[model samples]
Target: MWQHLSSLRARLSLLLVAAGMVGGLILAGVTHWPLPQLLAWLHGGMGQDAAAPTPVTATATTAASVPMSPQDLYVVLAVGLVLLVLAAIWLAGRALDPVSRLLRALEGAVASYRDGDFSFSIAANRRDELGKLIRMHNELGHTLREQRQHLAQRELLLDTVVQNTPVALVLTDASGRVAYANIASRHLFNEGRSLAGLDFAELLAEAPQVLRQAVESGEDALLTVDMDGSDETFHLSQRAFRLQGRPHRLHSFRRMTRELSRQEVATWKRVIRVISHELNNSLAPISSLAHSGAELARRGDVDRLPGVFATIGERARHLHGFIAGYASFAKLPAPRPVAVEWAGFLEGLSLHCRYRLASAAPERAGWFDAAQIEQVLINLIKNAHEAGGPDDEVTLSIHDGGNETRVEVSDRGPGMSETVLAQALLPFYSTKRAGTGLGLALAREIIEAHGGRVLLANREGGGLRVTLLLPTAKAPPRG
Candidate 1:
């Protein structure tokens, strides 16, 4: 019965009633305390005489003669009223004690909620309003738990999508600060540090215009960011949206380097097609003219025929050289590697290029091929020598790097420009005055066939450095 009233509303109601009763008692005492004294004084002032007469008169006279004091009467009445009020107050407090306890429990539940503890519950077995309240509290807790679980699942799904998405994705806030970055985005941008809270513009300094436009328009924007110090391209896309009632932007990046490479290859193929058609047309007529001139010369028709033959021969030789260069580009044979002692091969190459090597600085030595490798070395050395001035020197160094061997040919010449370096391996792309540009192209083709890579870079001090890396041959088993 006591526990039935133990609720916030019940406790509040009890407290209000107790306060009102106390206030009313205090007010009544203040107003009525002096009334009894004033009434006694008024009765005394009425001047009624008292005398001892007969038997009835004697009893009245005796009661009148033994007069009661106003102070004593007031004290008696006040003490009785005080005792009654104390008993009522004690009973009321006892009745309200359960309510006070229930209020405390409710307060504890609210405090736990404030502290982020959502698992607390209140017990109520009574069939009253307090029981209904407890049931509601339990229901509220269940709803909160379900909501929390749903939120957690949503976050997990978002994480999985971000990690598995093929395209890179980065999310930022209204202030352009990075909020989240997917795994693909981090890999594509080469971002090692945590992306959260980083300024988007600072991260994408390579292409700030895209970020700026996205922020300004609050919409999706597409742009390209060219990777520095590499032959890679990235396609960037920025999108804006609201998340959890706050505006955010997402930036996506995809590597488009392969696409660009395909486009360059297509362009080269078209150029090759046009050159082949023109060269064939020009070569046919020149070959026929040269044959006719040779016939005239054979008939012993003297002076005019001799001059014509010379002219025909010169034109035919030029055409022949042109055709040969074209054929070399057209017929690039695939590589076939065979094991050979690389050290002895390089030594033979040095001897073969003895004239150029004698003039060059002392060669740096290691291990590489003899015939095929020598061909690559010879081409590079010739190009280096041609590029270097008479007083300038060309240097060749061999490096054995455990798993692979490298041959470096460096020259103290004016370094190649960016355009030249980019297109050096392209057929017919030459910087020389009277040279066929198929040398580097053929050298590259041969090196690639041998499972090697050729790299060209400008030297720090001056000139260019060409590095050739070849895999080392595995040793045979012991006999």
Candidate 2:
């Protein structure tokens, strides 16, 4: 019952009832004792005065005016008090009605917000604290609604992009079930059928062997597959991340055939231009020299003939060497693998290039084309020496991975810019005035011929680091 009376309305009703009871008791007491005694005293004093003789009619009138007994008056007062309390309670209920309604509205609005329906608001029509609270609630609702609208629009835009993008995107849950697949992925894997809830492995069951192998490897790879009798290349990228405290994976496949074709055309154009320019450079000087030599012969200037022949021969040799470089690049042969001790290989390389050993050479033997690898290292070390760093700071390190050998040459010099690093291995790309641009390109070709790769990156603090990753066993070289 006390808990029931805890509310404002119940407490107010109780206070009103208590005030009425106190007032009724005080009225009953005064009317029953002090009021009647005072009247009797006044009447007695009037009768005792000799000059002011009371009329018999006046006394009768006064007796008549005393209407009821004290008992009857008490009853009437109690009934009045009861009626007043009932009226007060009714008034209190009316006064608190608006507040009760406001409380209910607030509850519903909160529930709506919790349910992600931010469109609910309370009406405010007063200039009091309660009204102020209602206005604030409305403002909060408005803010939430605006935020929700903006969020929905953003989500729609993102979904549209993801759905329409050309790259095939697939998202898988921890159990390897396909949770989401975009339009491209659906078309590529299942003839435009939805891929949700399907096994990811089953999707690859009918895929080309190259793609399956690449995906199974769980690493970024570029693969070529024969589709409809034509070869197409794709680059696959995979990433794993946690979503809502659960693991998920994203796989992306981007077709690179068209892009690679464009790049190939551009590379051949560059090669042609370089060859033509070199040919013009060497032929122009030789043509003038030949004309001068013929003039001397016609004049019988025998003494200058030998000097002219020497210059002509030198020019011929330069032209021959330039053509030979291109021919060697075009006709690079497969690498002949051989087991070579790292110590002996490093000793042999040290004879041709100067470098500081950054770490001890791996004791394990390396399996690759020894002569080709030596040439690649020689070219890289030469580049480092000429890279304008301190000669002593040029460093070489070797790591013996279980299945691969890594050889790194680092130099403390100005590192390559992003653009230079990107195309550094492309044929005929050079920065030097007299560079043939064949050294790094030839090195890349040789290493790739040995079924290896060349990686270039800017080292921390300064300079460039070139890494050659070669297989540790005798793997047949790629043609």
Candidate 3:
């Protein structure tokens, strides 16, 4: 009942009317009622006959009483109630109007928040508590909106960095699941989806131990991993760091294959510089000594001259060949690539050796120049022939790989030692007694210039295998 009464406009109006009615009743009891009763008493006591009623008339002096007829009193009370109700209605509407407007604004604000519109703002023109609350809400919403924008931008920047970094980058979650990988990382790892979700330990099994140390210590780690099924090398850097309050591991990879190649070139240059200096120093004196010996022999001191002259001439010839070999390492010509048929090329190369074909040759060929490829083939074939035992066989084969043409020269001999195999391409570093150490190095330089690679590995059974990979022309015969 109280709840119903509290919600009723009429009840509120009635309460106001009741207050005014109580006040009017008090005034009536104190003024009109008492005075009338007192005048009636006075009239009777002043010798006016009590049996006859005193005549009353409507005048200013008798306006309060005139016996106050019941109908007139009823009309006065009704007028008073009506005036009180009108005042109550006006006062209530005036007091609650701002509240009703504020309630609507609050509803709109909530709806905006629900719809993810943080831009909505409330007006705070009043100096009341409601106004202060609106001001605070606006301030809070502005802060939250700014924070959301900052977080979004930060996320975008991180994504761009991961996608476009030059080094191969891989990100892993706290539990070691691969979460993201960049383009370079995919190409370097060589396994499609290889690093994704794979345990770091498994993915980096071939990596050096430093990588594990870095992860455990929460510091950057550096290690080298040899590419599987290829001769390429990579330098891996691993670091553990936090991203947006979550622990993550990032691995950066750089291909060291080219670095190794550059090192080989530098080492060869150093070797040539030293050998050239020494050979020139030695050859000058030997030539002079040979000339002096000839002069002495012409002057009749023939005995000493013969031994000295023979020694000088022989030493000069040896020094000449040594100098020639060193010069060859320094002066390899640039490759000029052109198309050549594989069958005819091999047949021509075979003319330089007394070799029999073991199988039918490939009909189609690739885009390697004849002169350059011939030099590479002869060096490899000669090495195979020299390395093979008398009864052991040497085989040369050509076949088509998907994007490349491969040429393999195999020799059945005790394969190269690990040390020799590792350093075989180094200039002036040869195992053969007669070798000047420039053959394999020159071959590698030439082939690389032609956009090809040379690989030396041990054959499955018991020999050294030299494989040449050359990029083929587009749209080659599929079969």
Candidate 4:
């Protein structure tokens, strides 16, 4: 029964009943009993000595007919009201004690949640509104705990990936202190020691000269470092970003020596195969033609001898050209940069291979090896013409950007696919059966020698565009 009445509503109802009963008893005493007898009864009921004599033999009608004086009525009424108010206050405090404690618990739980602690939960012992509220708070705590666990797991997985990756990653704060460093970075910079909280500049000061130079440059670069008597190549990249309203920088170093070695081996193998195939094509025919010519000479057939000899000569010339192509690529010389005028250079290039001027030629002179650049343009223009486009549609445009010259050779023809475009600049890689594949590769070698770059892209609608970016002449100079 106590458990059932533990709720605030039940406790309050019982309090109301008790107050009503007390009020009823007081009213009966004041209306039916005389004032003297009433006071005597009140004093006797309170376990105190009666100040007035008790009317033991008095009749019930006489006691009922006695009227209470105004002063006596006021005293009785005042005492009754005071007693009632005290009883109500005591009952209210008893009924609301648990509620005050529950409110304090809720405030404490909220504070815990704000502090990112989700382990605390309120006990839900009753089934009242406050009890239901406690259960909901517990549920909220449970949900928050689950989400926090999932987030923690995700962060751990991310840390594992970053730590185990082969690329060395380092993050530095705006004050040049190391904020984070992965396992690879630790090994690379500190011989497997932790790098956190160290000065980034101090760490770099102890690093290899090549690595120090690359980092100091603040530019993405490929550098080679001699380590344990073996040269290792690494590509370094740096990026700056804001985190938590503060600037930070991330530096990543990826070792590229192994990848480069693999590519070099593959390139050598391809070169050997191409050379063997070209040699067999030329030598096999030449041998057959020589045997045929000898057989005709044995029969005194001189007319066919000349034809066979001419065929052999043509095969020899083709073989010579093929061999020379490889030799030129292998022995590419350093560029001799010189001042070059646009009109004269373009005219000379046009004489070798035709192209329409798509944009007005720039007036400023460019700095590069004119002979080498002319050869590259000739090869490109010839390719544009042979791309199955109309001869007139082979267009060349030159733009004079601030510090560089952009020469674009575009053709309206079927463009190269992604796969083809990717490997087109590689030596001995070609789509045409008769192509030596040295044209584009040699062009790249020459342009790079001139401190320039070659870019290839498909034109918007249909066709290909080859852009050559060359440094412009800052002043007139000779090779």
Candidate 1 Cα deviation (angstroms), residue 479 = 31
**Per-model TM against the reference:** 0.41, 0.69, 0.43, 0.73
Q: Alpha carbon lDDT of residue 63, candidate 3? A: 30
Of candidate 1, the 10-residue stretch with the lowest lDDT total is 354-363
lDDT (Cα, 0-100) at 341 in candidate 2 = 90
Backbone clashes in model 3, listed as residue pairs: none
Q: For residues 60-165, could you state the per-residue lDDT of candidate 4 as single tens digits?
A: 5543344556776788778767766876787677677778889899899989988999999997687766787889989999999999999999999999999999
Candidate 1 local lDDT, 1-479, one digit each (tens) = 66547654676677678767775665555345444445444554443545333444534432233344676467646765775577568757776676676788889988988887778788867555666777888788778878878989999998898788877788888898878887776665445456778787776664445444544565444445434555545565666679999998777766667887897888688667646755665566666766776676788656676666666667667767777766866775554455555445656777756323322222333223345567778888888877764434677776667677777888878889999999998766677755567788877777666667889999887888888877665432111
Q: Give a tens-digit lDDT track for model 3, residues 1-479.
A: 65445443545577567667766764575346754455445544553554554555522354344464465456556755665577667757755776777888888988998998888888758655556677888898899799879988999998788777768888898987777888777665545455667776566554545454544565453445434555555565677789999999877766677888899889869776667766766677787887888788789888788678777778778877777866765676665666788778877897886444555676666677788788778888788888864433787777877688888888888989899999998666778755667888888877777777889999878898888888886432211
Model 1, residue 365: C-alpha shift (Å)? 12
After superposition, the stretches of candidate 3 with alpha carbons farther than 4 Å from their true spots are: 1-295, 298-318, 474-479
Q: Write the per-residue lDDT of candidate 2 for residues 129-151, one digit (tens) a residue.
A: 66678898889889988998999
Ranking by lDDT: 4, 2, 3, 1
lDDT of 4 at 245: 98
Runs in model 2 lying further than 4 Å from the true structure: 1-107, 124-137, 172-178, 190-209, 242-247, 333-341, 362-369, 398-407, 412-414, 445-463, 467-479
